[model samples]
Target: MKLKIINSDKILYEEDVFYLKAPGLNGYFQILENHTSFISILKKGNLKFKNKKKIKKNLNIEKGILKVNKNFIIILL
Candidate 1:
């Protein structure tokens, strides 16, 4: 899946991800390749994702929005 993280100023990240974990408004959720399309509100918490190269990254995000469609992820913070 392709994931992109963007803010008002610039693009923070753009890459292919194998797995993702996010802090949804209600709770934490996970995403993988071929996941269903959806959108959600994000809260302040740790966000985790693994890349195609099997490298894992962690981010502490503030409030934001998350959009997922056809294996593409867009995070607006």
Candidate 2:
């Protein structure tokens, strides 16, 4: 799936990820390939993703919003 993370100033990350884990307001949730579409408010916590190469990455984020549509995911911080 395609993933993009952006803030007011710049794009923090943009790539194709195999899996994603994000901090939602209620709890943490994971998104895998071909996941259903939805939107959620994020809390202050860590955002993680695994790339197609199977390498994992992490980002410390403040409050943000996440949107999933089709096979693309976008995070606004």
The C-alpha TM-scores of every prediction are 0.97, 0.96
Backbone clash numbers for all candidates listed: 0, 0
lDDT of 1 by residue, 2-69 (tens): 99999999999999999889999889999988989999999999889998899999989998999999
- lDDT for model 1, please: 0.94
Off by over 4 Å in 1: none
- Candidate 2, residue 17: the lDDT equals 98
- Lowest lDDT sum, 10 consecutive residues, model 2, at 47-56
Q: What is the per-residue lDDT of model 2 for residues 1-77, given as tens digits with 9 covering 90 to 100?
A: 99999999999999999989999989999999889999999999999899999999999988999999999999999
RMSD of 1: 0.6
Per-prediction RMSD in angstroms? Answer: 0.6, 0.6
Candidate 1 positional error at 50, Å = 0.6
Clashes by residue pair, model 2: none
